[model samples]
Target: MAKRAFDQASQNQPTDEARDAYLEASRAGQSQPPETEAPAAPEVEGQETSEALQKQPTEAEDDQQKLQLEPEKDQTEQQQKLQEETDKEHPEAEGETAAPEEPETEPVDFSILKNGTVNKGGNVVNEDGKAVGRVTEGILKHLIGKKVDEKGNIWSTDGKIVGKAEPVSESERDELLKEPAPFESFPDAVVDKDGFVVSNGEQVGKVIQGDLAILRGKSVDPDGDILDKAGNVVGKAVRWEPEPEPEPEPEVPVDKSILAGKRVNKAGNVVDGSGVIFGRVVEGDVKRMVGRMCDKNGNILSESGDILGKAELVPEGEREGLKEGPFAELEGCTVAKDGTVVTPAGDIVGRVIKGDAKILFGRAVDEDGDILDKNGNVLGKAERWEPEAVERKKNPMSGRKVNREGNVVDEDGNIIGKLTSGDLQKCSGKEIDDDGDVVDYKGNVVGHCSLIEDIPKVEEESPEDKEKREQAEQDKKLAIQMSVCIEQCLDKIRPICKMITEKIDKAERTPEDERDEEALVREVKPLIEEGGRILSEAKGIIKGLDPDGRIAANAKHKSAAREATPEEHHLADVLKDLTGDVTQCIDNAKRKLEDMPHAKKELNPLWGLLNEPLFQILAAVGLLLAGVLNLVGRLLAGLGLGGLVDGLLGTLGISRVLEGLGLGSFTKSLKGGKKKGGGLLGGVLGG
Candidate 1:
């Protein structure tokens, strides 16, 4: 097998020298026939000596001799020695010789391996001069400190064959350089940098260090070839065999009979025949029955086994109502077996009596005992049943009494059978009077009642007193009519005064040359006349109300006015003030209108000339100069040099020059002079 591997590896050799060396090694390995058992010495009568057996060549000595001599001579010498030993040991069988049994050689694939040479230092190096690994196995111990050729053939100092170097590769060299993974069995095994299994720099092998030692400088290829750094085949990777999976335990079938006659309670617990909770069904189709008191037959029942509904009878969303039995049918309300109506919060709201329901609170109830909505409309009703009597009380609003049956009663102690509208009536079918008395057809008081207060009697007045009263009423009527007229006058005066004020303000805001004095007068004249007319009319009405002027005279006297009634004095004073304001507003409007014509005459003709385009351009230039000088003046003022600006303006005499041109105000602003006038042109024209 070693020869076969060498032959295959030689085919891939890069150089002829390497190939020849591989072939020579293969031939050398092939020259030695496998060691076999020496032929048993024939029986010899006189050769019973132990010395001859001891002197006979052992297998190791024979192998060494074969390597030193030619192959044919070695075989011939070995046969002659065996014959001599057989004759000495057993003379009777001297002519008979037993053939040797060939030894078995373990097969190794050398194609995946590379040659490594052993140097004088006892370390192995591959063809690239890189360290492969040291051989420390006892079988190849003689090769230590001996020279090995490129073909891995090891020779002694005398040129005798010993053993071959193990194979190594570049790929294994890289793997050895990695941080070693922890291995429990090879705690002491470590790889050196040169890819040798070492213990503190001393070479080791599998025989001394166990199987883990072989992995120290080797790596398992993907194909499971264990290789050393120099491409030598070291060992094979042991395939990991997983522990067999435990045989699945056979499934124990559920009897399912245990669930017979079971039911799911409102809490989702599965109850058995006696309603004792067995276990809970957490999921699956059975989970839909959670919070539903349903039996296995799908009958939704109460805790007492009353069938309120069936699971299939109601939609899935409405099934929760089954838990409460019949009571859940009524939304927001519930009814007791005794006909006591209650809200879902268990508050008693009404009662069902004799198939008629009555709600004591603000809510209304129908004949079927269901509470009605805000508009007294019933949504649905509960089952009707006769209930026990509930006490009756009088209606609070009417203060009328009620019978034991909750019907209204009149003053005659007659049952009115629940007043549906208005108050109760008499037994005669006549409406009761507001004074709580019942009268006959002729208007005679037939019944004297105390259900409400009695009506008071009114006395008749004397003729003389009536006359004074009528006269006083006539005076009050006249006063109110005069007051109304006064209000109308003031209402008219208000708009006139507002018109005059607005026109005057508009004229004041207008530029003198632009003001239309005639238009202002025309607009204000009518407003002032209207205001004067209103004031005159209002004063006449006031005089008519107080024909002697006594009310006005009394109002002027503060002490006398205090002694008089406040209403009388206050009305007189309001009318007096109204007349005064109307007159003042008229006089002010006339004065303002009268002054407009004169003010219009005083406007400078140059102000009108300023409106011309040439004059406007000159004004713009003057305005620009004013703005620049104004900025300079402000800067000088901020720097505490304001006096300098004043002096500069005085020296320039710009103000005097502008004054001659009717632009004195413009230059004054640049000189930081007092701010006055409507604007640039308004100040120049002195309007």
Candidate 2:
């Protein structure tokens, strides 16, 4: 006795083996059912004995099966008519009928037959319902002991012809499958569960809707070669191949002498080496961008504006003035003594107006306050303190001029007073000669100056003048060092950047345990802090030159960096590459660290499903395979092959397999997964 395990579905449906066994008796040349049937002997230990293994069909499947029968009834009638007409001319169809009409009657119960047979009206199926000849007495006599030939012709084993072959096409397969797609080539084609095609009483080749390649009674597979009943190769199909990927471009080398950097504002725009906006984040979950970002034409950014990157566009029109102008260069320059502004280029452009950041434009001016151009032509009016007033403040002895007679006179030559010995002693211009006598501007002896005649002959300085002179020297040194200060700041950021880059690269290659994320942050933090300190110092040094911070620079950087010296402008780009790169690198390191735990957590459940070492290895391999399939699925989508691939996946049940592997979403995502809020979730999944 054969024992069998029956599941819920199996309990409702008989297996194809049971049905095929019933067909076996008919194929065994049984003419009629025996009077007393013997019980079937089941000796095979592992062999299936029940027909319940065959999946039960729903009402829709039932309709499809009925559909196969409906077409054949009409086809059989047409063929019988054709045979009847042929019989009128040929002896070969002599026995075929253009039979007279008979009274309508109920179906004949072939009580002699044991099990049963699949029938369409009066016709019967020989190839498991993909019939080649009818079961009617007339046709049975002709088909008895016959087999389907290589050409699908029903012929006696002794070589007598019985029936014609049918050609299996797409329509035949569509009829076989329950949920068939719309294709209208065949008008009356039919197929059984065994991949056999039958139209009327003629047998046909196998058909498959999914694989598009038939293996006799085997299931469809598109990538497989077409094989006959004996597994002989009969035909081939051209497999789909995705487009070849383009080779990656090489990276450009940078000059070692200059440290490069960028600044990404809160808006996710990238500033490059020249304060020009290089690119902007246009897409993704960048909802936190501080402001709307635009390009040269004022077009909005379209890329997913990551917090750090370089902008790719240079703006047009007056915007150019923002980037390359004399005033722009003066940004980050140094202030000199004598009220002159010393740019980093080592040129004096103008004087800083007292008590304000205003520049004098260096126009020539008269003592009485008249502005003049280089040609000495009056260009404009200027305001200044009168010479006399300035002189009065400079000296307390502001009154009289002395004549040759040593008499002091006022305006109009009126004699106001006579020069006294004390007045002569107080005279600034009067100096005691080597002979110790007081002399006037004309070397005339003004008086025999009393004691303390040795006035030390040393020029004394005012506190204010001394301070101004010292400030001038400091300014001169600073003007020369502006570039150096900025370069130093960027240099500090560079090593940190390199370390972060190296860390990210290493993380990609090694497992999480092997990653030195802590070391990366440790190395990068101080460098960033130090970079920040250097930037602040550099900005302070250049503040006077860039009062508004468009140029000479600051820690609060933007994309407007420029240099006073045209040749050294690249150096003055203080906020150019450094700021964005430093922050971006730091963020990248942090992101990698953050992502690791989540990735492991998401994958851990899958790992938990496996315990044995072999199973673990298999799980790993499965993940790898899933990764590969996901990649291939993406490539296929890129090539515009969505429908074919999706259909194939469904057919081969690879889609279900992927779902079982926890990559279900990945495989099905191609159809409708475009906009996923395009934000945090998008970034997370993409990463």
Candidate 3:
């Protein structure tokens, strides 16, 4: 076998040499064609250096060595003795050679070997008296199988020897055993049932029956050689055994509740344990149901890292049967254990170990038990886990401050059913007033949720009970208000009735509603006008009613001088000045009467002609006239009257009287004046 292997290598020597030469040439920056040669005939074939080529001595030495194949006589004699010893062991063998026990003049060559030749077992001998070796698969394989003696020479199983091989220690032997065996060096025991090389109980790689081979590492080169762990030439390799893709990591089990109403954020992320978000959460979805949250820009705001983010909570059972690894899991809509997530009912439950974020679907909830959007809007109704009336101090962070079935308190300390947006949403069993509606910061009502209490035993007649209840409430309120007002007016006017009753000789009765409203006005008008005048006169007497008033009035005048926006105070000042002018004129008229006593005689007859008293009577008469004029003047002035008659009356005392009278009339007229004049006049005069 050794001789045959040598012959085959020698025949393919030219090709081998060419491959080697091309490799060498490439290293030298040269290009050369690959050579084809026969598969047998051994020779030392290679590119020789120019010096070695020019000498031609190596060839001459080869020829001389060929001629020297004949061994000495003594060596031939020793071979014959060995042949006899071999024949003695197998005496009945045909063509057995029992060589003559004498030296021949022509020395015999022993290096020649024939097919099936054998010396003892399968060891082959050449004609040059050399034991060549046994034949095997190839030189490399055979060399690997051969055992080396203490002298470092490799000996075949048949005792044929070859060149010395490198020595290895027992430690080296263990290391080689640990290292994956080369494809060609595989022992029969090394193969598995699949014909793959097994090492340490695992199939290291496979070997093909033909030229193709696959080694340990899953790498293939252009030359079809598979590399082993050490990156050495292991075999005439084919494509690497495709590593059976690791059985997809078994997926982790997820909870079923997580999937029931899994919520995610706008970016479709779930919430993490820290209440940080991992995905975008859109609006309207229950934020509490989302395990994770994200901003609109797809920025995950969780404790996890980039590229390999730890999924927040996902729906339970969503990661069913998934394994763990960076790339092992895809972004399936499944939740894993240890992931944080929210439930459909807005319960925020944390994930268990071995969980993922895929379990959640939309919107995210926070640890505060509030459902929030990516845009930070509170999601859905802010349902408290418990009632609002409980002691808040005990479980300050317990999302529900009250017991499960009690009232809830909002941030504003209002007892609400469920609070939202920093305000009270509902107060159980309480009626909604005008201020009960929920509104945005701009005071616009956004939406509403209703609260109703089932009144046991008191069945509602229909759904219209709300309207009935509301109307009944309003009517009760108005009735109470009307009773109080009527009682107050009666209390105030009772005394005045006695005074007016004795003055009348007879009285005509009229239905309360049919009585002339204008006559009622006329009867009260004089008093209102008189009261207004008195008030004006008192104001003038007081110098300044309040220090702030004078300062305020001055400020108004200054403002008018600056021509700022038209103000009520500015108009009031102009009226006040006219009143002052009117008051001065009235004082001057009084003084003129006192200065001219003779004029009273003329005035007295003039008064009689006029069907009124003069002097003291005229003063009283002037008082009434001033009251009427003051009212008319104030009315016209207030109506923005700016005419010569207004200016003249303002210069006279009548303008003050008019203002006093008209100020109250216009106010009373504006106020539907029925009770005010009657009550106020009686209060002042009676007091």
Give the Cα lDDT of each candidate.
Answer: 0.43, 0.38, 0.33
Clashes of each: 14, 29, 90
Ordered from best to worst lDDT, the candidate numbers read 1, 2, 3
Which wins on TM-score, candidate 2 or candidate 3? Answer: 2
lDDT of 3 at 133: 41
Residues 448-475 of candidate 3 have per-residue lDDT tens digits of 3223232234565775688646644543
Roughly what TM-score does model 1 have, to 2 decimal places? 0.27
State which candidate has the highest TM-score: 1
Residue 522 error for model 2, in Å?
A: 4.3
Question: Which tens-of-lDDT digit does each residue in 581-619 have in candidate 2?
Answer: 443454355456555664433332321111112111212
Return the top candidate by lDDT. 1
Score every model by TM-score: 0.27, 0.16, 0.15
Report the Cα lDDT for candidate 1: 0.43
